[model samples]
Target: MDEALERDCVIAGGGPAGMVLGLILARAGLRVTVLEKHEDFLRDFRGDTVHPSTLTLLGELGLRERFLALPVTALSTLDGVIEGQRITLVDFGALPSPDDFLVMVPQWDFLNFLAREARRLPTFELRMGTEATGLLHEDEDRQPLEEKAWDVDAAVRGLRATSPSGVLEIRATLTVAADGRDSGLRRAAGLIPEESGVPIDVLWFSLPKPPDPTPPTLGHLSSAGMVLTIDRGDSCQSGLIIKKGEFTQMRRAGLDAFHARLTQAAPVLGPVVGTLTEWRQVKLLTVQMNRLPHWYRPGFIAIGDAAHAMSPMFGVGVNFAIQDAVALANAIVPDLRRGAAPVRTLARVQSRRERPVKVMQRIQGRGHRVIARSTTGRRVLPRPMVALIRLASPALRRVAAHVIGQGLFPEHVHTGSVTPRGGHGEVGGVPETWSKTRLWHNEGN
Candidate 1:
């Protein structure tokens, strides 16, 4: 197609990753456009917790105070439950940052904040209520097979539904897929993800704020699947973990039955459940965690849920998405300025994010196993196994601390300067080009 129709970058999906990336690129004076299918920013209970590592990134972007000033709840620490006892896991204070705690903000509000921020940048354009229908590609001049010649032209076409408009074809030097777990872009590109079996889904609901006598913070209830009570202070809401496909039955049983199940899980949550006036108020979400085989192909690159979708068990979805945005921004800025090869730039981003992504996957997988085992798996597993987890609550807390406080994905730690090296030659049996960057193995902050 016409080269004049293209832009510097086109982002699909206006979630945390897309918004942050648009802001970063626009600030750098690069032409960027974000296409979102949703017409508005209003969304229900999505991932709300922003971990410290993400907060640190916000600080680096000079947005810490602005972010913190938004309506949110500051959770100083996370508390886990095993066999009825509550154990404080991962004290945020231990982390070497002022914003150590997880900051809880409604997903809709946060996304709105990001969208508003993105609009302020002259180079950034947001096309809401529009969807990317297909991709367009331009053939690059072919080179020898061994020389790694690849297609250099691929752009996203967004169709707007509103009147006074025609098909808006946005060609970008690079296209980013931030479209989410069931990403149309990824599927359109025929990319498959490697799934890690972390088997736990969640049933989410928000009740009227419980009375002041109720608990002020969240806690996992050992008796009833994992319970998270988000006390807005005035009116609190609670979320309960349930088996996959259990939501339909719960909804069929009617609202009263669902409220009973929640109240039974945590009696202190009764006040919140009692005030539920409508069955439609409750929402159910199925959580899955998986990583793409490759984050990029040719002129396209995927980030956030498009690249990897993790369980909401640890509430790290938004945090990790924002982190991916930062990493992608950092990696691509130099390339955009230098007019580097598109494939090389995407490869650099994938390589830079590899270690952090693997680390997070492992952590999420472990957490899912623990929670699933504690709840539904208890019936199938031996009694000794259940007893062991209950007996080792302290160890579990320590593990949680390492995973949550230190960051399930520590991309921030990987952001320092790289040392210069000598001529291209074999070093320690590896090529000199590959050995230039040293991977730091610093464990435990």
Candidate 2:
């Protein structure tokens, strides 16, 4: 066992929520460590759309230009196709500056960008290839991991994570679990998300993008299934929505039928369907829409997918998570800097952000249920309504575009200093680097 390390805050999972929180808090001069179970952010079937709200926050940090220099496909308009007729679904061009369009970058690239930026903070330590296994309370006040307490959670002092160096205890004034839906820390803390009754699953895979430098994002509905294609320069990240728990039957029906359905749904995309050859290429994402009844315990809090697992309908999952991080940092940076973790302050973070999340989830749950009921039709709206909306499409598109581009409660960046120009994206100070060969622990005094 390596010697235990201490930090102002220990965050589990280096996803958008955790990384963003680490970056902001460290900028406010708090010692923070982010633990990521994976060695790299190369996971596929992830939310990649960078919404307007996130872009605004990036611009506030003055890293917007640096970040946008990376490869991306900007989607200015969202459209839907039915029976070969195209209709504008959402137009982003009418939205605010710096983030009117949704930019489709690979999930890996987005994560790498955040990680690189976070590393520029002297107080932020990101440890990949490590995972939180259990929670810790002050002293022996920690409860057993198996016990379930609906209204109570141990005032977490820190957590234990398994790393290449063996089990190392991380002690912190505050601990945050941002580890996604199946979060181990959330379970250990006895936190559960209340189901919002969303009913849909997605089959995701990659297909060739159109030759254009920027392809319009398209949604196609057919008698068979609804397919969505988001352009990513060389490839399009495609997803087919199916009824909840229907993947087994879809597979039993065979891949040929699936390919046929894809072709029938969007003949424009037929040429690229052949690229998705093997069953191995297809990935199933079990959609979930739920939020925690309570997002915090005494010394700990849950954010992002750890607190709420969202449906993938609007591609706002990552954007919402980023919002949570911004809100959390703005609310708690002072306490962390002062060596305190007040439960009331943590509760306020959830209270402020919960309404927008609930509103988005309700919209998604209702929309998905409606989509599930339409089978004989090739479009979500009735033919008459589709035609009617098209008559006033320009006006309707802008309204929906604002909701998707800038969320109900968009969060702004509060505190993150731009990295020094001389160093190559690395901050001046050294952070604790824990490894099996040599255990390194550095905390700003």
Best candidate according to lDDT: 2
Each candidate's root-mean-square deviation in Å?
A: 10.0, 5.1
Q: Scored by CA lDDT, what does every candidate get?
A: 0.66, 0.79
Model 2, residue 383: what's the lDDT? Answer: 75
TM-score of 1: 0.80
Candidate 1 residue-wise lDDT, 292-374, digit = tens? 87888776888999998977766777877877887787777656645443677787877776667787778777766666754
In model 1, the runs with Cα more than 4 Å from the true position are 1-4, 139-164, 212-215, 373-402, 406-409, 412-445
Task: Compose the digit string of candidate 2's lDDT tens values, residues 1-445.
Answer: 4758889899999998898888777666677899999999999989998887888887766667787899987888888775345778888888877678888888889889988876766667899999998877766444554563434644788888899879878989999999999999998888778887656788899888754423365677655568888777777788888777888998899888888888776666776787777888999998888899999998899999999998888899999999999999888876776789899999899998998999998889788876775443445667777678778888888998989889997888655342332355324233322221111235431
Q: After superposition, how far is residue 214 of candidate 1 from its true place, in Å?
A: 4.5
lDDT of 2: 0.79
Worst 10 residues of 2 by lDDT: 431-440
